[model samples]
Structure formats: C-alpha cells, structure tokens
Target: MIFIEVIKKRFGHFEGETVWQWTMINDHGMKISVLNYGAIITSIETKDKFGEYANISLGFSDMDDYLAYSPYFGATLGPVAGRITKGQFSLDGEEYQLTQNEGANHRHGGKLNFSKKLWNVSVEKELDQIVLTFEYTWADGENGYPGNINAHMTYTLNNKNEWIIDYTAHTDKPTIYNPSNHIYFNLSGKAGSTILPHQLWVNSEKFLPIDKEMLPIGEIRSVENTIFDLRAGREMMEIIKNQDELLQIAGKGLDHTFILKHENGKPDAVLFDPQSGRRLEMETEADSVLVYTSNSMAGDFEINGKTVPKYAGITLETQGLVDAINHPGFGNIVLRPEKPFKSKTAFRFAVES
Candidate 1:
C-alpha cells in the first residue's frame, strides 16, 4: 500500500506562518519527503541490496540549514535554469534586465528564485500512485521577467519505485521559462558520503562547455575523447579527479550540460552504486541534461547525520540548454500565451537481487 503523511516541521519567518513536510511512502520501502517551503525534497529513501533503507538524496535534517546553506538542494529552479549573461536578455525587440544576484549574471531566477519560495500544494491519490502537486504563481515584474506565470510541479510516487516529476506552466505574456529541480543523488545513501563510488551513464554524445564566467560559450562540443563522455558508464572518482580543463573550469568537477540523444522518457541516464547494489534509472522529455557534481561544497552540509564531501551527490537535471535565450540554436525557452511549458522526468529506483 502507498501511504502519505503531512507533518508540521517548523515555524516560518512570519507570525502565523508555518513550514510543512509531506512524505509519501510506498509499500516497497521507498519514502520521499518534500517540504512546502520551496517544495524542496528533503529525503529520497530506498532499500539497498542488503534490504536496509537509507536516504540517497543529499539534504539537511533541519529546516534552518536549508534556508542558510542550501545550494538549491532538491529545490525547483526556474524563470531560467542557468545563467543570464549580465542579467540582460531581449525578446521581441524588448530588452529586459533581471536581478544581478550572481556577480553580473542573473542566475536561477534571481537570488530568491523559485528554489526559495513557498508553494501551495494539493494532494491526489490514484489507485496505485500518490501525487503531490506543488503550485506557485510568479508576477511579471517580480524578477524582471516579463509576464505573470502560473507554474505547477507534480511529484508522483508509486509502489513500483518510481518518482516522477511533471512540470507545467503558463504565462500571460511572452516571456522566458526553463524549469528543473536540483536534486542530487548518491545511491549509496549512508554507506558513503561522496559520490566517487557511484557509476553514471548518460545518453548523450555532445556536451556544452562553459567559459570562466560559467556560462555556455555557444559551442556544443562532442564528448568523444573527453571526460564528459559517460555513454558507456564510468566511476565518477576518476573522472572528477582527472586534470580536465573543462572539469576544473566547472569548479574542479562536472557542471556541464549534455545534449541528450533520447526523448519521451526513453531512458536518458542511469546511476548505480556497486556497494549498495542500488540503481537509479532516469528518463526525461527534455533535450538536455545538466550533469553536475557537487564540486562547490565546502563540507558544511550533512546527509544522513554525516558531513558530506565535495562530490557528495550528482545531479542529472533534465532541462533546456542554459542561457538559451541568447543562443537561438540552443533550443527555445520562450513562453507565450498560446503555447504553455510542459516537461516530465522520471526516476526509477531499483536494486539488484
């Protein structure tokens, strides 16, 4: 049976305000805990080969840590997924300026982006799955982005060990929109603090390289002869430790985007941990996957009561190309009233017998 629970986690910043934790537990020993504040996922627990359950998703045990130290941990990102050069973009002959929160670039919908907001949630129970739909409305001038957008994110957990995320949004005027979550997975759970022992495989032959400014240079380089090539699956430790220019440029590890060759949820990637015998299968309806190793961690955060390492987890964010607004060929991030935004990504967790 699938079970769902709602618990009051803590008090909010304002009087009479509160934060909540919603957990969905499947019969097969998989549990997912999400918070209403930022609609952030706090836990993703699954059983390993030895039939012991642990949280494989990196996050804090307290809500305060999330507010102070979260690097978009398990939070939804939007308005735009990546950096906006110099916090400026033009659409339909109109120039717009966004909040220059990250140096001179507008990143991840600004400082108080979607990752740090409260969302209204509605729960739905189907015969086999529990769906937690989180919704947030963005004002046109809130982040210097044109048009008001009503965004929706649906999280579904079923007994089949699937956690599916479906994103949908509608804008009242012509604007830009690219949304994805920043959930990092380690697969090894409490067995390991770093993702070095994990193996990753992505369904892509090319990757987007970034300059010193951490924005794409408009070149979609082939992954051949590069450490970014994980088409055949490889351990992350060797790749992360390689003296690769791109890796070093990306904070000493991967923060690159891979142009996906598959679509319509046809198995875009896989993450496995030999120690736990846990495997995570990913499928998405996105054109690209941003594979980010948590290379920027300063060893301040804890996962499962243990301090995490720099490469504590890896994020396979299925979203559009970063800063696609400036690059016409990178893919469209434009949202019009006539056309809405819709994307889906599914994470299937399993273990070898």
Candidate 2:
C-alpha cells in the first residue's frame, strides 16, 4: 500500500507571490519533498541495504540557496535542455534570439529559465501510487521563445520504490521543446562525499562530442575504447582519472550525452553504489541521456549547513540531443500545433545483493 500526504510550508516569495512546498511519502519507505517553484524535487529519501532511509537528492536545507545561484540542483529544465549556439535559432524562415545565460550559448532555456518559475501543484492517488502533478504555462516571447506553451509534469512514487516522471506539453505556435529534470543523485545519501565510488553502466554505443565551451560540435562519436564506455560498468572514479581529450573539454568530468541503444521506454542506464548497496535503474523515452558529474560544485553550495564539494552527485538527464534545434541531423525537437509533446522517465531503486 502507498500513502500520500500534503504538508504545506513557506517556500519564500517569488514575484511578490508566496511559494509553497509539498512532501509525499509512500509505504515502500520512499519519501519526496517538492516545491512549486520550478516544480523542483527538494528531497528524495530511499532505504539502503541496512534499511536506513537517507535523502539521495542534493539541495540546500534553506530556500535561499535555491533562490540564489543553485547550479540547477533538482529543478526542471525546459524550452530546451541543452545549448543553442549563440542563443539563436531559426524556425519557419524566421530567426529567434534567446538570452545567453551560459557565455555565448543559451543553456537550459535562458536567463529566466523554467527552473525559476512557480508552477501549480495538484495531488492524486492512482491504484497504489501517489502522484504530484505540476503545471506551468509560458507566454509567447518569454525568455525569447515564440510560443505560448503549456507544460505539465507528474511525479509518481509507487510501492515498488519506483519514481516515475511523466511530461507533456502543448504549444500554440511552432517551437522547439526538450524538457528534463535535473536531479543529481548520490546513493550514499551523504552530502559532501564524492560519487566517484559508484559504478555506472550506460546502454549506449555512441556519444556526442562537445567543444571546449561544452557545446556539442555536431559530431556523434563511438564510445568503444574511450573513458565514455560504460557498457561493462566501470567505477566512476576510474573514468574520471583518464586523460581523454573529450573529458578535458567537459571540465575533466563526464558531461556528454550518450545515445541510447534502446528505443523509447527501455532501460537506459544503471548506477550502483557498492558501499551503500543501493542500485538505481533508469528507463526513459527520451532519445539520449546526459550524464553529468558535479565537477563544478567545489564547495559552492551549502547542504544542511555543510559545504557540498565537487563531484558530490551524478545527474542522468534524459532528453533530446544537445543543440538539436540547430542541428538537423541530431534529432527532432520541434513541436507544431498538430502534435503535442510527451515524454517519460522512471528511476527504480533496489538494494543490490
């Protein structure tokens, strides 16, 4: 059996409006805390082999850290999930300019990205699962995007210790859309510790190559002999020590998008922490998975009043290829009036024997 509860708390004010927080728990010992601001998952607690519940998602205990420079923490990325060169894209013979938040590129939307917006939240129980739905509408020309888009996301935690995220969106005009959740996970459930000891296996044979600026250079390369190869499940620390050029370009860590070998709704990656005996299986309908190690953290943010250093967590962002809007060969991220956008990603947690 699963249980759902709504606990209202003050999450600070945004745009002269008060934001709220909600906490959801299940019978399987899974608990999730979320906020309507950015529809962010503030905390996710799960049991380890020793049957101790620990919060695996990284964030601050206070609301101020999030309202400040959060580094994307557990926020929802939208409008576009990756970089668009020079913050410019053309659609239907017209060029659209976006805010360049990441140097010369428009990353994870724009200056006022979806992560900073407040969403409407609703709760419901379906069968044995508790679902928290968050809805937000973006007006045309918001952040320089040309569409009045409505987006909805449902986060469901079930009896099987599975957290499923369902995303759907509709647009009034033709636009590019690629939404994803940026939840960094540390199976050890301990902040300030690196995730290098974890083992990772990505079900991918190819990965996109990025330039020094961390933007995709329109090349899809094989992961056979490089450190990007995780088919046999390598320790993340070992991969980080390799002197590969691609890894150097990404701040000496793994931050590239791996092209999935499976189709939609198939298992894409597996992450296991031997020390904690916690295993995570990720399945998604998105075309690619961007695996990012928190290399830039460097004690920048405080979690529970303690500093969270670099490589504290790993992010498996499942979405369309980076820069897909400008690259015709990458993948289709265009959403027209006739067809709405839909995608799903799920994380199944278990104790490995």
Candidate 3:
C-alpha cells in the first residue's frame, strides 16, 4: 500500500552530479518534501486546529536560499551537534584534535559536516504513512573526526499526526557521532509571530551548567527554584525574562540541556499554543534535551522575512549532553563496528478544544 513520486531538477551539467526533488504525502494529508542535495527538508505541511494546512517548519523556498541564506533550518545536523571543547579529545590513549572552524571550539561538525554534503535519498509511500530515507558515507578524518561511518536517517509521518525521526549510524573506527535534525518549530507558522505565548513543560530536575563557550561544567545543578525548571507548563519567554538568576547565570536566554527525568514510556515535554489551539507532545530516548530560542535570527533570509524577532522560535533538540566526549561521567560516544548506534524521537501534534 505505498505510492512514489519523483521530481527532478537541473543542477547544471557537472560530471558527477544528481539533483532531484521528491514529495511524499500520507493518507491524512501530511506531506514532506526532500531534495537530493544536502538531504534537506524542503517543506512540511500539516493541518492546524482550524483544519487548515500550512508549513510548520522553517525552510528556504528553493535550493539557492538553502545554500546562501539559511542557517541550519530543517537540515540534518550530524557527526556531532554541539561544541567539542578546544576541538580536542582523547580516545583509547590517542589524542585527536579537530579543526576549530567556529572561534575556538568545533561547532556543528566542523566546516563541512553532513549538513553540507549531498545525500542519497529514497522515498517510501504507504497507505497511511510516508517515509523519506537518507544515507551518507563518511571517510576517516573527513571533518577532523576519526571514523569511516555510514549513517542512515528515516523520517516518517503517520495518519495519527505524528512525525517521527530515527537515526542509525555505525563506524569502522571508534568516533563520536551525534545526529539530529535542526527543524525550527513555529507552531503558529513560519511567518507567524513569536512563540512566547506557547506553554511548555519539561520533565527534568537538574541541568548541566555551562561556561561562556557553552561547555558543560561537570556538575548537574538542581532546578528547584531556577528558571531552568519548566515543570509547570509556563510561558517560555515570560519565565526567561522574569527570572533574574537564570539571566545572570546564562545571560539573556536559554541554550542549555535539561536532563530528562523519564523512567517509563511517556512524553518528556509538551508544548501548547492557545491562540492557535495547537499542541505538540515530544517523546525521545536521548539523555538530555536542549531548548534553544532563536535569539540571533537576523533579517538576512528573504521571502516573507522578519517574522521571528529575538527569541522567536524554540528548538527542542534531543541528544546527549554537550561535550560528552570529554566528560567521563556524562557518558561516552564510542560507536564500534558491531554495535549500531541508534536514537529515536517523536512529535505528536493535536488540536485542543
């Protein structure tokens, strides 16, 4: 019970090049589009509370905007997501130094990580759901990291209004790999207003404190009375602006991870926008969740620009804590040849009465 459609585009007559566009729509009308280059999500359309369909994720209109203007919107962030302290780590008594492309620390996978590469894409359409698959092969020392890894990512949308993203990677040599999507959620729409009115709740009792470079400080600080506590489902910006202690500790906004407190099969976070009557529940197996407010979104992106001001969109990223390779207690990022490293996260959208 599957359907398939392929749309090809011209990307010049280069020797070894393949350019194409594909869209997969489920029976429930949930649609997802992907391009061969960058393995980027071109558009994702979902119905709102009013039964109106719209694109909920932020993305560029075409491939050119994706290359020049966009800053990781709706792209697969791979190899590693956050910072690598001093661009260095020691594994099995061997010290490896990564390229410091962004200032002093290695950021979002050094210069040309998975996001910048063209991936081989395949589409699977079923009776009730659609799946988009992307595969990438990385050689040893491709981006200052040691690994000959093969990564596969599957994106699926079901009739029950759930968007699931699953990642699996294996390496011939032991190396760190953290892969996730950079999909900015503006529940109100891409050109809509800020997400300050949305209600958010995270099931976490402690958060890892970080320094100015955004590296964890080897301690799990309590969030009893701190602004980091989102256990009560409060407005995100209201809590951020009013909490003086959090402002003092982490500056203007949040860019940190909350160690999830889930011990069973349930959601760790929930977000609701009353104005639109749209709700989203998140479930993941990752150890920590990083919530980032788009504090630095300039008006550089065109076509209905200037939608999100400072702290407009909120990113709920599920992954291990930042700089896990260096912190012994935080866990290790060793992917061996026999073990297939895997992680899964899901977002369920609903309409409230």
Q: Could you give the candidate ranking by lDDT, starting with the highest?
A: 2, 1, 3
Give the top-scoring candidate (lDDT).
Answer: 2
TM-score of each: 0.95, 0.96, 0.91
- In the range 1-353, model 1's lDDT, one tens digit per residue, is 43544334553442245777888877675889898888889889999999999988977777778877858888888878778899898999999999999899998899888888888988887766889999999998988998999999999999789999999999999999998889999888862378898899998999999999889998889999888889999899888889989889989888999999995545899999999999999999888989899889887666556677788889988899999998878999999999999999999999986
* Higher-scoring candidate on lDDT, 1 or 3: 1
The per-model lDDT (C-alpha) reads 0.86, 0.88, 0.76
State the displacement of the C-alpha of residue 101, model 2, in Å, after optimal TM-score superposition. 1.0
lDDT by residue (tens digit), candidate 2, 176-210? 89999999999999977889999999999999999
Candidate 3 — which residues are off by over 4 angstroms? 1-19, 190-192, 243-251, 303-308
Clashing pairs in 2: none
Worst 10 residues of 1 by lDDT: 6-15
Q: Write candidate 3's Cα lDDT for 1-353 as tens digits.
A: 53333344554211267556666666667667666666767677777778887776677666667667657777777688888898998887889999887788897788787778888877776766777788999889977789899999888877777879899998998888877677677777647467778888999998888887777877888889777778887787686677564454555677788899986866899888787777888989888888877766775555456544665577888888778888877876777788989999998987785
Worst 10 residues of 3 by lDDT: 6-15
Scored against the true structure, residue 92 in model 1 reaches a CA lDDT of: 96
Best by TM-score: 2
